[model samples]
Target chain A: DAGITQSPRHKVTETGTPVTLRCHQTENHRYMYWYRQDPGHGLRLIHYSYGVKDTDKGEVSDGYSVSRSKTEDFLLTLESATSSQTSVYFCAIRGLGEAFFGQGTRLTVV
Target chain B: QQPVQSPQAVILREGEDAVINCSSSKALYSVHWYRQKHGEAPVFLMILLKGGEQKGHEKISASFNEKKQQSSLYLTASQLSYSGTYFCGTEVQGNTPLVFGKGTRLSVIA
Candidate 1:
């Protein structure tokens, strides 16, 4: 309940297609993160933003990109979708003492 | 670095007790606990900062040992609601994105 929401709750895109997921937060948090959750790989970080126009790659930042132009919005884009990229993506905002996640986006590449 | 979680999965009867441990190779500044039900986003449970802090959430509690770079979550008298995949996230420093463990699946039966 940290006022975070992920757009496109579910998406099915073809391989090689470009897909972008959006995360919007109303809490005005400085730290925002993107993570993908798979069966055995739990939550793997993809990208994160510390402030407007300031972002960093995460452990699993291959084939994916992120941009944050405003404090309330963070976007994750898959340049070319692949079957391996089919998973649930979560967006989180780090608050003073804890982090809160968005509902999540389920993307499937066919 | 991603933290390693012990007991990949666990099953328990209602009212039973269980503990999940998370260890990180890198030094940690904070440990965060979260639970995710199937097809849902993870919900924050608690966070323990540096200084070897211990915190509780109802019957669920966690202890963080900064010296060993490890954290343990304890669930006492588990209920059916406790059934979910538990993930422990570690941060090397304040305001940094968290790296999560593979997760510990817990199932509580009646």
Candidate 2:
């Protein structure tokens, strides 16, 4: 893991409940991304923020939302958790070269 | 679109060599390689820009071919630490988020 941190390293939630995962970075990088990793799917981008208060949807943004109030924090929210959303979520900060990832948050929706 | 990775799984003996390939249907501006161990986050390996150049990361090296929209990761003298899932992420262009392949799981046995 790089300078990025994801809170709630592990969580078990119920379907239909709301959940939010937080990613904090000390790198002060301009690009922050939220991704979910599942078996056979590798990692799929959920959303990304280029700068503070600037966010955009990713390839698999449906059923997910993101907010970037500050350059150091990016939050991913699942309005209503679904079983399909259970996976390991990772946050990455892109530097001039490669993207550094957080330890990851494993969320289980039961 | 997500890139396609070949040989979804591989078994290699320590000190052996392995190659993982990633190909994209769309034009590629850059390619990023990352490795994720079981229960860990993905760590950056290397990045190759559109120049289709080859870059090295320790015993691992990568080559990108922009014209073919593909990238290959080469592991020389594989070590036990190299046993992990390798993912290739592609950026269609600058300022765009990456789309990852399904990943290639490498098992380096002693």
Candidate 3:
């Protein structure tokens, strides 16, 4: 696993509230990505960071933002929570061979 | 854009075989495969690079058709441990992150 952890393993929030999920990795890999997993919908990337301060949007980036100020940490923020925004968030670090994922954060918007 | 995966779900008996396919709308630099067990984080299975000249992890294998903009995963002699959701993610423009497909769930029964 190489020391990958996601904070607040599970969270329940109300609609319209701002939320931030954190991903930390001990690995010095250069690539970090954030994705959401929902039933019937596989893992869809929301955003990714190639390097410090170098970020890009993925297939589903709306209503979400990301920041990677350090090599080992990436943060994903939801501007305002909505029912449709509820899903399991996973963070991954990529290496030459394969990618490793964090445990995941389960968020529910009610 | 997210690559689309075929056969949203599948079922197999122990010792049987299964094939999951992933296709992209545009030329892909690489295609990645991963499997996630229920309530667990996704673990990388393999990635096929541009030129369709890559294969990864003997236990789980995949092939990429650069010209066809597609990739397929092969599971031979399936095991009970292989029961999970399999996803295919594609990277465009080379040296970038990925956009994943909806996923294909495989259940191996005894």
Native contacts present in each candidate (fraction): 0.94, 0.92, 0.92
> TM-score-based ranking, best first?
1, 2, 3
Across B21-57, the per-residue lDDT of candidate 2 in tens digits comes to 9999999889999999999888889999988799998
For all the predictions, what are the DockQ values?
A: 0.91, 0.88, 0.77
- Which of the predicted structures, 1 or 2, would earn the higher lDDT when compared with the native? 1
The lDDT leader among the candidates is: 1
- The TM-scores, one per candidate, come to 0.98, 0.97, 0.93
**Which 10-residue span in candidate 2 chain A carries the lowest summed lDDT?**
A92-101
Give candidate 1 regions above 4 Å deviation.
none
| Candidate 3: tens digits of C-alpha lDDT, residues B1-46 | 7798988999999999888999999988888898999999988887
Give interface RMSD (Å), model 1. Answer: 0.7
| Residue clash pairs of candidate 2 | none
**Candidate 3 chain A least-lDDT 10 residues:** A92-101
> Candidate 3: misplaced stretches above 4 Å?
B54-59
Q: Is candidate 2 or 3 superior in lDDT?
A: 2
Candidate 2 local lDDT, A1-110, one digit each (tens): 46889998999999999999999999889999999999989899999999999999988998999999999999999999999999999999986768889999999999
Show where candidate 2 strays beyond 4 Å. Answer: none
Tens-place lDDT digits, model 3, residues A1-110: 56799998999999999999999988898999999988887888899988999999987999999999999999999999999999999999886656789999999999
